[model samples]
Target chain A: MQLTGAQMVCECLIREGVDLLFGLPGGAILPLYQTLPEYPKLRHVLVRHEQNAGHAADGYARASGKVGVAVATSGPGATNLVTPLATAMMDSTPIVAVTGQVPRAAIGRDAFQETDTTGITMPITKHNYLVMDTKDIPRVMKEAFHIARTGRPGPALVDLPRDVLTETAEFDYPEHVNLPSYKPTLEGHGQMIKRAAQLIRESERPLLLLGHGALISGAFDEAREIAERAQIPVITTLLGIGAFPGDHVLSLGMPGMHGQAHNNWAIDRADLIIGVGMRFDDRVTGRLSAFAPNARVIHVDIDPAEVGKNVRVTVPIVGDAKRVLHALAMQVDKVSRPDWIAEIDALRDEHPLYPGGSGGLRPQRVIQEICEATDGRAIVVTGVGQHQMWAAQRYVFKEPDLWITSGGLGTMGFEVPAAMGAAFAQPNRPVWSIAGDGGFQMTMSELATIVEHNTPVKFAILNNGNLGLVRQLQDLFYGGGRVASGYTGNPDFVKLAEAYGIWARRVTEESEVRAAIEEAAAVDGPALIDFRVEPEENVYPHVPAGESVFETIESPAGREALAWLT
Target chain B: MVDVTLNTERVHTITALVNDKPGVLARIAGMFSRRGFNISSLAVGVSETPGLSRMTFVVEGDEWVVEQVVKQLYKLIDVVRVTNLSAESAVMREMALVKVRSNADTRAEIMQLVDIFRAAIVDVGKDAVIVEITGNEEKVAAMIKLLQPFGVRETMRTGRLAMTRGAASGARRERAHTGGSAPDAEVVP
Candidate 1:
C-alpha cells in the first residue's frame, strides 16, 4: 500500500509491536505528530526535553526487553540525544532514536533546524542512516530495529528528512533482513564448551563473574543452574546487579570499585573465574595486572571483541550467554565446594561488608528501609554516583533485570526520566527513581513529564547538598579542597516537586525514612521524598581509582566510610 | 596467564568482503578506532561482485586480540566475510615504492639490490630512484633496510592484501562478462 513516510513509520512500529514512543514534537517532526492521531493504539509520551526522551526510551527497553523508540526534531533536538545514545551504547541497551532532518534539497545549505544527525551519531550508535527518500523508510526502519535489537545490542539512529516524511512511498517491510554479516552466534562451539567445562570441573575455587550480558541474553536461569550445581560463588559487576538473585547463599553480591573487601579478597584467591556475559571493564578489574592474580579466566560474551580485550582469556566462548552457559552446564558434573565456600566465608568474616552512616540521614539506611517496605519487588533505577552505589549495595534484586543503572556511561540525571519510562512500560509493577542531590537536580525538569502523565513512580532524592562521590575523591586526593565538588544554593527538592503538583515530603531524621517511603509507595500517582543526608559521606571500601582492590581503604582519617556496620 | 608473545606488539593483516553500501567503510574504521585498535594501514576497492567491496586493514595486536578483531568484523551488518590473512595457509603480499637517493656512486649498488629483490625501478629522477617491489613482509623489509644506507628519500606501501593459494571452485551462475569467476571465488562457505 502507498503511504506517506510518517504513516509508514507508524505502521512499522505497530508491526514491531511498539506501543509507546517518548519524544517532543518540533518544527521538523510536525508531520509525524500530525499523523499520530491516525494510530490510536500507539501511545506517545511528550517529554520535557530530548535527552529525557532518550533516557526514557532506554529505561523502557531495559524493562520491556523490546526496542525502545525515541523521536526528536532536527539540530539541537537531535544533538541532545547524544548523552542517552552514548549511555545506551555503553550499557548495550537496545534503543531506536528517530530524528527529523532537513529536507534533501536544503540538507547542505545550512537550512533551518538542520543538522548532520547521522554524522554526529555515527561514532556513538551501532549503526545510523540518513533517509533521503520515502521509499526507503520501511526498509530502513526494519534494518534499524534489527540492528538495534540483535547481536551486541545498542542504540540505532534513523534520521528522517522532513521532505521524506511528506512524500508518498510504497510500504513493504522485508520478511527477513538479508544481513549475512550481522548474524550473532546463538550457539557455542562444542570444543570451546568442552574446554570450559573441563576448566570448571578442575577448578576448586571457582567464581562466576556475572555481567549485563547475562541479563540481556536472559541467561539468569542457566547462570544459576551452573553456579548452584558447581557450588561456585557468583560475583557481579556493577551492571550485573540483578543477573543472579542477590539473596542466594552463593551470591557474593558485587565486586570491583567500592565492592566489599571480602569480595576483592575472594577474587584475589580464586583459582578460576568464569566471566559470563560480562566484559572485564576497568571498574570491575581494578588494576588489571593484579586483578584475579591467581585465577584463570574463562570468558563468555556475544561480542567477540570483548573477549581477551581487557583481561586475558583462557577459554573464550563467543555466543549468546544463555546458549553458551547451557552448553557448558551440560558438560559439567556436580561438585561440592566446601573449601572454597569456607575460604570466601572466612574472607567475609575478616573484612565484613558494611554501610556508610551519618549523624542525620544515611542514604544506605533510607534505601534499605525503602526496599524493606516494598518487599524488594520494585524495579529500582538510579542516577550515577554515591546514591547509585548505595542503592546497589542496600537493595536486594530477587530476580534478573529488576535493577537498572547506567553502568558503563555513569550517566547522571538518568533516574527520574528512566524510572518514568519503566513505570509507563510496566504499569502494573512498582517503579522507583533514586537519585543523589547533584544528579536529581540535573534532570528534575522530568517532574513535569511525570506529573503530566501521572506516572506512578516513587522518587527518592538522597539530598547530601554536594556531589558526594566527587567530594569524597577531592577530599581524599585533592588535599581536602572542596572546589567544584561542593554545591552552593542547592534547591529544596521537596518544594520543587510540589511545584510540579506532585506529592512531596522532606525527612531530615533517619527515623522518618521508612514512614516517608511507605507513604510514598502508598500513593497512586507520582511522589517524591527528599532525605537530607549528611554531606561528605563517601562510599567505601574504595579501591582509590587505578589501584588494586586488595589495597582498599575502609575509611579516611577523620571519617568512617561505613560506620553503620561498625 | 601464559603470555605467549614476550612482546605484545604484533601486526595482523585482515581482509574483509563488505556490502558496497554507503558508510560501510566509516562504520568499520570507526569501530576499530573507538575500540582502541591502532590501524597501521587500510585499503579498499570494488570486489569481483556487483554489490560487494573488498577491504584490507593492518592492525597491531596479540594473537587473541587479532582473533577477536576478525570476529568483531563479522558483527558489522555490511561485512559478509572476514579473514585474518596471517592465520591461514595463504599467500600474503604487499606493494611498496621506495625512493632512494641514488647518486652516480650508489646508483649501481641500488640497482643491483633491486634486481636481486626482483623489483622494478619505476622512476629514476636526478638524485633518486623509485623502486616498486611486491613481496612478503620480510623480503620487503630487507630491501628497505638495504636501500636505507643510500639515504632513502621517501617510501609508501600498500599495507597487505592476501588470497588463498590454488584455484578454489566457486558456484556462480555463468555470466558472459565474468568468465564464471564472479567473486564467490573468495567466499568462505
Candidate 2:
C-alpha cells in the first residue's frame, strides 16, 4: 500500500505493538502529529519537555519489558533528549526515540530546527538512523526497535527529514531483520556453564551477585532456583533491586557504598562470586583491587565488554543471564551452606544500620511507611539523592522491577515522569515517586504532564531543605563547612502541587506519614505530599568514596570512625 | 586462575564488511573513540559485493581490546562481519601519494628512486613531483625516508587494506572460532 512517510511511521509503530508513546509536537514534526490522530489505538502523552518524554519512555520500557517510544522535533528538542538517552545507555534501558529533522534539502544548510541528530546521538544510543528516503522509514523503524530491545538493550533513535515525512512511498515492513552484525549470544557455552557449576560446588562460601541484567533478562525464577537449590546467598546492585525478594532468607539487600554493611562483608569473605547480568560499577566495588578479594568471580553478561571491564573473572559466560542461570541450575549439585548462612546472619545482627533520626520526622520513616501501606506490592520509583538510598535501603521489594531508581547515571528529576510512565505500563499497580527536595524541583514542571493524563502516581517529597547527600559529604570530609547544598529559597511543595491542580498535603510529623500515604493512594489522579523530613539526617554506612567496603561506618556518632581520614 | 590480563602492547589489523551506507564511518569511528580504543589507521572502500563496503582498521590494543573492538563493531547495524586479520597470514598494503620537492636539479634523482621502488609519478609541478606508491607499511616508509632529503613536500596515505592468503578466509576462520550460526560474508567475485 502506498502511504506517506508519516503514515508509514504510524503503521510501523502499530505493527511493532506500540500502543503508548510520550512526545511533544513542534514545527518540523507537525506531519507526524497530524497523522497521529488517524491512528486511534496510539495514545500519545504530551510531555512538557523532551527530556521527560525520553525518561518516561525509559520508565515504560523498564516496567513493561518492551521498547518504549518517545518523539520530539529536531535541534533543541532532540538535544534535550540527550540526558535521558544517556541515562538509558548507562542503565541499558530499551527506548526508541523518534525525532523530526529539517527537510532533506535543508539538512546541512543551517536551516531552522536543523541539527546532526544521528551524529550527536551515536555515542549514547545502541544504534541510530537518519531516514532520507520515504521508503527507508519502515526498515529504519524496524531496525531501531530491534536494536533498542535486543541484546544489552539501550536507546535507538530514528531521525526523519521533514520532506521525507511528507513524501509518499510504498510501505513494506520487513518481518525479519537481516543484519548479520547484530546477533546476540543467547545460550551459554556448555563448557563454561559446567565450569561455573564446578566452581559453585568447590567453594566454601558462594555468593550470587545479581545485577540489572538479571531483571532485564527476566531471570528471576532461574535466579531463585539456582540460589535455593545450591543454597547460595544473593546480593543485588542498586539497580539490581527486586530481582530477588527482599523478604527472602538468602537476600542480603544491596551492596555498594550505600549498601548494607552485612552485604559488603559477605562479598569481602565469599570464596566464589557468580555475577549475573550486572557490571561491577565503581560505586558497588568501592576500591577495585579490594573488591571481593577472596572471591573467584564468574561473570555472566550478554555484553562481552562488561566481563573484564573492572574485576577479574574465572568463568566468562557470554550469554543471556536467564539461559545461563537455567543451565547452571541443571548442572550444579544441591548443597547446603549452613556455616556461611550463620556467618552472614551474625554479620547482619552485629552491624546495625542507622535507625533514622530520633527527634524529627525521618526520610527512612516515610519510605518504610509507604512500603508498609502498599504491603511491598507497590512499584516504587525514586530520583537520585539521600531519599533514593533511604528508599532502596528500606523498601521491601517482593518482585522483579518493583523498585526502580536512577542507579547508573544517578539522574535527579527522574522519578516524577518515570512514575507516570510506570503507571501507564502497569495501571493496576500503585506507583510512587520518592524524591528529595533537591531532585524534585529539577523537573516539577512534569506535574502538569501527570495531571494531564490523570496518572495515579503518588509523589512523596522528602523535603529536607538541602541536598542531603552532598551535605553529608561536606560534613564528613570537609570539617563540617556547609556550602551551597541547602535549598534556602525553596517553595512550598504543597502549594506547587496545588498550582498544578494536583491533590496536595503537608506532613511535618512522623505520625502523619502513613495517613498521608493512604490519603494520596486514595486520590483518583496524581497526588503529592511534602513530608518535611529532618534536614541534617544523612545516609549512613559510609565507605568514604575510594575506601574499601571494610571501612564502612555504620553511623556518624563515633569520633573514631573519622580518625582514619586524618 | 583465569587469565584476565590486559596487554596494551600489540597492534592488530582488523577488517569488517559493512553496508554501503552514509555516516557508517562516523558510527564506527565514533565507537572507537567512545570506547577509548586507539585507532592507528583506517581505510574503507566499496568491496566486490555491490552494496557492501570493506573497512580495514589498524587498531593498537591488547587481545582484550581487539576482542571488544570486534564485538563493538558487530553492534553497529551497518557492519556485517568483523575479523581480526592480525593472527592470519594476510596480504596487507597501503597506497601513498607523496609530493616531493623536485626542481630540475633533484627531479632526475627522485625519478630514479621512484623507479627503483616500483612507484609511478601521478602528478608533476614545476617544483614538486607527486609519486604514487602502493605497498606494505615498511615499503612505503622506506620510500618516504629515501625521498626525505629531497624535501618531501606532502604525503597522503590510505591507511591499510588486508586480505587473507589463499583459500583461508578470515570470516571463514572466525566462524570456526565463534562456533555459532553467524554466517560468513559472501565474497561476490
Candidate 3:
C-alpha cells in the first residue's frame, strides 16, 4: 500500500504491536505527530523531557517484557535521550528510540537542529540506523525492533529525516528480518551444559548466582528447579532481585558490594559457582582477584563476548538463560548441603545488615513498611544511591520482575519517569517511585507528566537532605570531611507534588510512615510522600570499593576500625 | 576466580566481512576506540561479494583483547564474519609510494635501488621519482630505508591487507584479471 513516511511509521508501529510510546515532539518530528491522531490505538504520552521519555521506555521494557519505544526530535532533543539510552544499554533493557533528523541534503550541512545522532549514539546503542530514503523506513523499523529485543537485548535507535517523513512511499512491513549476522544462540551446547551439571554434582559447595539475564529470559521456573534440585543456595546480583523469590529458604539474598554479609561469605567460600544470565560486574565482584577464590565459575550468558570478559569461566555456555537452565536441570542430581547452609545462616546471624545512626526515622524501617503495606506486590522503581540499596536490601520480592532499578549504569534521576513507565506497563499494580532527596529533585519535573497522563504512581522521597551515598563514602574514606554532599537549599517535595496538581503528604515521624504510604497508595491518580529519614544514616555490610567482600564492614564499629586501619 | 590472561601485548591482524552500508566503518572504529583497543592500521573497501565489504585491522593487544575484539566486532549488525588472521597462515601485503628527491645525477642510482627492491617508478618529476612498492612490512621498510639517503621528499602507505592461504579458505580467490592460479576457487562452507 502507498503511504507517506509519517503514516508508514504509525503503520509499522502498529504492526510491531507497539500500542503506547513516550516522547516529546519537536520541529523535526512534527510530521509524525500530525499523523499520530489518525491512529487512535497508538497512545502517545507526551513527556516533560526527552530523557524522561527514554527512561520511561526503559522502565516499560523492564516491567513488561516487551520492547519499549521512545520518540524524540533532532539535535538537542535526541541528545537528551543519551543518558537514558546509555542507562538502557548498560542494563540490557530492550528499548527502541526513534529520533528525527535533518533532511538528507542538509545532513552534513549543519542544518537547523541537525546533529550526528547516529555517530553520537553508536557506542552506547546496540545498533542505530539513519534513514535517507522513505523506501527504507519499513525495513529499518523492522530491523530496529528485531535488534532491540533479541539476544542480550539493548537500546536500538533509528534517526529518521524530515524529508523521508514528508515523502510518500510503498509501505510493506516485512514479515521477517534478513539479518544474517544478528542470529542469537538460543540453545546451549549440550557438552557445556553437561559439564556444568557435572561440576554442580562434584562440588560440595555450590552457589547459583542469578543475574538480570535470568529475569530477561524468563528463567524463573528453571532457576527455581535447578536451585532446589541441586540444593544450591541462590544469590542474586542487584538487578537480579526478583529472578528468584526472596522468601525461599534457599535464597541467600544479593551478593557483592552492599550485598548481604552472609551472601558475600557464601561466595567467598563456595567451591562451585553456577552463574546464570549475570555478568560478574565489579560492583558484584568486589575485588576480582579475591572474589570467590575457591570457586570455579560456570558462567552462562546469551552474549558470547561476556563469557570470559571479566572472571575466568571453567565451563562457559553461550545461550538463552532459560534454555540453558532447563538443559542443566535435566542433567543435575538432587543433593543437599546442610553444612554449607548452616555456615551461611551462622554468618548471616553474626554479621547482619543493620541500619546505623540514632537521631531520626530509619529508612530501612520505612522501606519494610512500604513493602508490607503494599503486600510486596507493588512494582518498585528507584534511582541509584543509598535509597536504591536500602530498597534492594529491604524489599521482599515475592514475584518475579517486580523490582526495577538502574543497576549497571547506576543512573540517578531515573525514579519518577521510570515509575511512570512502569505504571503504564502494569497499570493494575501499584507502582512506587522511591528516590533520595538528590535523585528525586533531579527528575521531579516528571511529576507533571504523571499528573498529565493521570498515571497512578506513588512517589516516595527519602528526604535525607543530602547526597547520602557520597556523604557516607566521604565520611568513611575521607575522615569525615564532607564537601558538596549536603543540600543547602531544597524545595518542599509535598508542596511540589501539589503544585503539579497531585495528592501529597509529608512524614516526619516513624509512626506516620505507613499511614503516608497507605494514603498515597489509596489515591487513584498520581501521589507523592516525602519521608524525612535519618540524615547521617548509612547502608551497612558495606564492601568498600575494590576491596574483597571478605573484608565487608558489618557495622559502624567495623567501619571505624577499617577507617583507622587505612 | 582464575585470572584470564597476563595482560601481554602483541600486534594482531584481524579481518571482517561486513555489509556495504554507510556508517559501518564508523560503528566499528567507534567500538574499538571506546573499548580502548589500539588500532595500528585499518584498510576497508568493497569485497568480491556484491553487497559486502572487507575490513582489515591491525591492532595491538593480548589474547583476551583480541578475543574481545573479535567478539565485539561480531556484535555489530553490519559485520558478518570476523577472522583473526594474525595466528593463521596468511598472505599479508602493503603498498608504499616513496617520492625520492632525485636529480639527473642521482636518478639512475634511485632507479637501481628500486629495481633491486622489485618496485616500480609510478610517477617522475623534474627532480623526483615516486617509487611504488607492494610487499610486506619488512620489505616496505627496507626500501624506504634504502631510499632515505637519496633525500626522500614524501611517502604514503596503504596500511596493510591480508588474506588466508589455502584454496578452501572462506576468503574470495583473486580475480581472473590478476592472473592468479585459483581464479574460480570455491570458499569453504
Candidate 4:
C-alpha cells in the first residue's frame, strides 16, 4: 500500500509485532504523532520525561524479551534518550528508539530544534540511521528492528527527518533484511563444544556460572539439565539471579562483590568455570587478575567481542547461549557427582544467613519471609545497592528468568519501571520491586504510571536514609569517613506513596514485617511498604576491588550483634 | 621459507570483497604493516552490492602471512573475499611518481631511465626531475631504488589498484558505471 512515511513507520512497527510504545509527542515528531490515532492496535504510553520513556522502554524490553520501542523529537528529546540508550547498550537490551529530526534542509544549519541525533548516539547504539529519503524509512525501520533483536541484542535508533515523515512513499516493509555487514555469529564451533564437554567431565570440582545471557537466550531448561546431569554447583551473577532456582541442591546463589560467602568460596575452589552469558563484570570479578585464578574458564557468549574482553577464556564458544547449552546437554553423558552435591549442601547448612534484630525489622529477614510467603514464585526486581544485594543474596528464586534487575548498568531508578514491565508481561504472576531509600526516590515519579495502569506490583522499600552501597564502600575503603552518601533530610516514603494515591504502610517493629508484606501483596493496585531499619547497616560478603572474591568483610555491627545474642 | 622468484609477467590485477563496517580498513592496514608488506599502489571503493565494500590491497609478504592474512580477513564478518593478483593469472598495474635532482646537464640521462621504465615526466622543475611510473610493486620499488643513486629528492606511491583475472571483468565494470551514475549525493537529514 502507498502511504506517507509517518504512517509507514507505524505500519512497520505493527508488522514487527510491537504492541506498545513509550514516548511523548513534540513539534518535530508532530507528523508521526498525527498518524498515531489511525493505528489503534499500537499503544502509546505518554511519559513525563524522555528519560523515563527510554527507561520504561528498556524495562519493557528486558522483561518481555521483545524489541521495546520509544519515540521522541529533536534536540533535548533526542539527547534525553541517551542515558537509557547507553543503559540498554551496556545491559544488552533489545530496544528500537525512533526520533524525529528537523527537516533535511534544516540539518547542519543550526536551525531551531535541529540536532545530529544519529551522530550523538553513534557510540552508544549498536547501529543507527538518519532517514532523509521516504523510500529508506520502511527498509530502515525493518532493519532497525532486526538489528535491535538479533545477536547481542541492543538498542538501535532511526532518526526520521520531519520532511521524510510528511513525504509519500511506496511502503513495502522488507520481509527479509539482507545486510551482509550485520550477520551475527549464531552457531557454536562443534569442536569447541566437544572440548567444553570434555573439560566439564574431566574436572573434579566444576562450577556453572550463569549470567543474564542464559535468560536472554531462554536456556534455563538446558542450564538446569546440565547442572543436574553434571552434578555441578551453580553460581549466578546479579543478572543471573533467577536464571536458576536458588533453592536447588547445587545452587550457590549469586557470587560477586556482594555475593554470599559460601557462593564466593565455591567459586574460589572450583577447578573448572563454565561461564554462560555472563561477562565477568568488575563488580562480579572483583579483581580481574585474581578472579577465578585457580579455575580454567570455558566462556560461551553470542558476541565475539565479549569472549576475551575481560577474563581470558580457555575455551571460547561463540553462539547463542540457549543453542550451545542445548547442544552441550545433548552430547554430554549423564553422570552425577554425589560427593560434590553433598559438600555444597553442607556449606549451605553451616553458613546459613542470620537475620537478627530487636526494634527495627531486618531487610534480609523481610526478604526471607517474603520468599517463604510467596513460595519462591514471585518475580523480584531491585534497585541498585544494599537492598539489591540483599535481594540477590536472600531471595530464593525457584524459577528461571523470574528475577529482573538492572545488572550491567546498575541504574537506581530501574526497579519500579522494571517491576511494572514485569507485571505487564506476566500479569498472573506476582511482581515485587525491592528498592532502597535512595533508588526508590530516583524513579518514584513513575508511581503515577503504576497507579494509572493499576499494575499489581508490590513495593518493599528498605529505607535507611543513605546511599547504602556507596556509604558502605566509603566506610570500608575511606576509613569510616562519611561524605555525600548520607541523605540527611528525606521525605517520608509512606506519606509520599499516600500522596501519590497508592496504599502506603510503614513497619518499624520486626513483628509487622511479614503482615505488611502480606497486606501489600493482597492489594489490587500498587502498594508501597517502607521498612525503617538501622542507619549504619552494610551489606556483608563484599569483595572489594583488586581483591579475591573469597576475601570478604561481613557486616561488623550486625555480625557482632548476632554473635552476642547467640 | 621457499625463496621462489615470482614470475611477475603472468600476474596483473586482484579484487577483494569485505564487510562494509567501520575500522575494517585500519585492521587490514595494520596487518600489512606488521608483516612489512609493501604495496605498489592501491585503490578502494564500495562494491556493486549494498553493505559490501571492496578494498584493493597490493603487497608482497612471505607466502605464509599473506595466506594467513587472507584467511583471517575471511574470519572478519565484513570481509567476503581476498584475491592476490600477483599469484593469480590476471593483469596488474600501479601508479607512482618520483622526483629526482635534475639539471641541464643530466636531463637527458634522467629521461633515459623514465623511458626504460615506461614512465612519464608529470612535472619538471629547474633542478628536479618528477617522473610518473606505473607498473607492478616490484617495478615501482626497483625504479625508486635505482633512482636513489642519482640523488632522489622526493617520492610518493599509491598502495595498489586491482581487478580480477578473467570472466569477472564485465561484472565489476557494470558496477563501477552504475555507482558513477548516482552523483554521490549525501543524505541531507
Task: Tell me each candidate's i-RMS in Å.
Answer: 10.4, 7.4, 11.1, 16.5
Q: How well is each residue in A334-424 modelled by candidate 1, as lDDT tens digits?
A: 9998888998899888776556654767787888998888787889999999999888877888877778899899999999889988998
Q: At residue A127, give the lDDT of candidate 3.
A: 94
For model 4, what is the error of residue A146's alpha carbon versus the real structure, in angstroms, after optimal superposition? 1.8
TM-score-sorted candidate list, best first = 3, 2, 1, 4
Best by DockQ: 3
Comparison by lDDT, 3 against 4, better one: 3
DockQ of 4: 0.06
Ranking by DockQ: 3, 2, 1, 4
Q: Kindly report which residue stretches of model 2 are placed more than 4 angstroms away from their true locations once superposed.
A: A558-560, A563-566, B1-8, B123-126, B173-189
Fnat of each candidate: 0.22, 0.25, 0.47, 0.04
lDDT of 2 by residue, A302-419 (tens): 8866766677777878788999899889987888999999999999998778888688898888989999999999989999989999999999898888877888888999998788
lDDT of 1 by residue, B1-189 (tens): 332232576887777888898788888987797777778888788889889988887888866556556656765667777766644656778899999998888889988999999999999989999999999778899999999889888999887777665674112211111001222112121
CAPRI-style class, candidate 3: acceptable
lDDT of 4 at A479: 66
Give the number of the best model, judged by TM-score: 3
User: What is the model-wide C-alpha lDDT for candidate 4?
Assistant: 0.77
Per-candidate alpha-carbon RMSD to the true structure: 5.9, 3.2, 4.6, 9.0
DockQ of each: 0.19, 0.29, 0.31, 0.06
TM-score for chain A in each prediction: 0.98, 0.99, 0.99, 0.95
Per-residue CA lDDT of candidate 3, range A433-520, in tens?
8899999888878888888789999988899999999998989888788999999798988888888899999898889998888888
Q: If both were scored by TM-score, which would come out higher, candidate 1 or candidate 4?
A: 1
Residue A166 of model 3 has an lDDT of: 92
**Of candidates 4 and 3, the better by DockQ:** 3
